[model samples]
Target: MDRLPRLACSDPRLTRLIAIYETLAPATLGALEALFAPQARFVDPFNDVSGPAAIRRVFEHMFETVDAPRFEVLDAAIGAGGGAFLLWNFHFQSRDKQRTPRCIQGTSHLRFDEQGRVLLHQDHWDPARQLYEGVPLLGGLLRRLREHLAAR
Candidate 1:
């Protein structure tokens, strides 16, 4: 689990961003045009993209690859200068029927423009625990490696 700096949630801008993310879906990706600036940047463990279309594409891809993908915003903080941090869990079921629904806990750091549209979004999470550890052969190998490293 990565620790993130705490932020206040009193800012309405931050509140709106949280709401948008909590209710986000591929069909409602159009809502991003209102939540994010045209040139807003988004980055995560797997993606580094800018602009609303590119960002929407990321979410679209998630929908295409997963089942019932959703976000649950757990907490948030608002900075004095339009910066915010959100702690959330991304819940989804794997495309493969054998796999069950899982939750990936992560934190989003966002910078909003003066008008309250997101200007930048960065995410931090542990891929080993959230993703790779659930894989088949790779899961065992990664778990062993983690144990080996932790013991040293």
Candidate 2:
């Protein structure tokens, strides 16, 4: 697999945020309050919520559902007007005895507040291809549907 080139970033807040993501764990969930604004909004394919508490719950649920879930920041860039983008790969294992490992590639768009805390964080990724396509029965069905829908 080709690796993405990591971009150099000078912004301290963006650097800190990236570090937080790369090192995230159940013990570090408390750090969200410092990284996000009181009313920050977080949106992903599965959850859409506002505030640090709600965002914490989202991560909490992830921890409960998966084993050893972690994020690998492949590349990051700061955008104009206090915005930033992060390309990341999420790695985890299923909770079952087999513990099948999975990886999901995604990107996050972040807008920072004046205080350098995240005001909005939106994640973009394809659930059908990255997630559901790996399931047993569902995976086969989705692959068949995808083949059927493709241009011949």
Candidate 3:
């Protein structure tokens, strides 16, 4: 099993981003029914969903495959210089019975709505290195490289 300590959902900005991810990961449609702006849009490598319902659906799909997932904000910087950014690491196990937990890094660029809901969320990460390569022998190699990169 793998664990990534979650962020404290106290600061309003971090709270919103954390809420979006949590509701998405577990497909907790009800939890997000009123959380987003009616015209909000969310995009990622595998999903480009608009409006709350569509976003909820994308999350539902994610829950089907990802198991026991957690997203941790390793660090964050915010100021008038630009929008807030969270340096995050995502960790999860696959639903595949034999798989171990997988970890990946991403940078989340966030903007708040007029009401402080997360309006735009752009995630930057490489699916090829973070996810696709996490399969068996290929995964071993990726893991080795990832560890090497981390050590540096």
Best by lDDT: 2
- Among these predicted structures, which one has the highest TM-score? 2
Q: So what's the TM-score on candidate 3?
A: 0.70
Give me the runs in candidate 3 sitting further than 4 Å from their true place. Answer: 1-11, 19-29, 79-82, 136-152
- lDDT (10s digit) by residue, model 1, range 43-142: 9999999998899888889888989888877788776765788888888988786768888998999998878788999999999977999889999999
TM-score of each: 0.88, 0.92, 0.70
Q: Return the clash pairs for model 3, or none.
A: none
**What is candidate 3's lDDT per residue for 35-135, written digit by digit as tens?**
66777777888777778788777667666778877767776666484467887777888778786788888887766677766566678889868786767
Order of all candidates by TM-score, from best down to worst? Answer: 2, 1, 3
Instruction: Report the Cα lDDT for residue 7, model 3.
Output: 51
RMSD of every candidate to native, in Å, equals: 3.6, 1.6, 4.6
Candidate 1: list runs displaced more than 4 Å. Answer: 1-8
By lDDT, is 2 or 3 better? 2
| 96 Cα displacement, candidate 3 (Å) | 2.7
Model 1 whole-model lDDT (C-alpha atoms) = 0.83
Q: What is the lDDT of residue 135 in candidate 3?
A: 72
Error of 1 at 102 (Å): 0.7
Pairs that clash in candidate 2: none
Lowest-sum lDDT 10-residue window in model 2:
1-10
Tens digit per residue, CA lDDT, model 2, 52-135:
999999999999999999998888888876689988899999877799988899999999888899999999999999888888
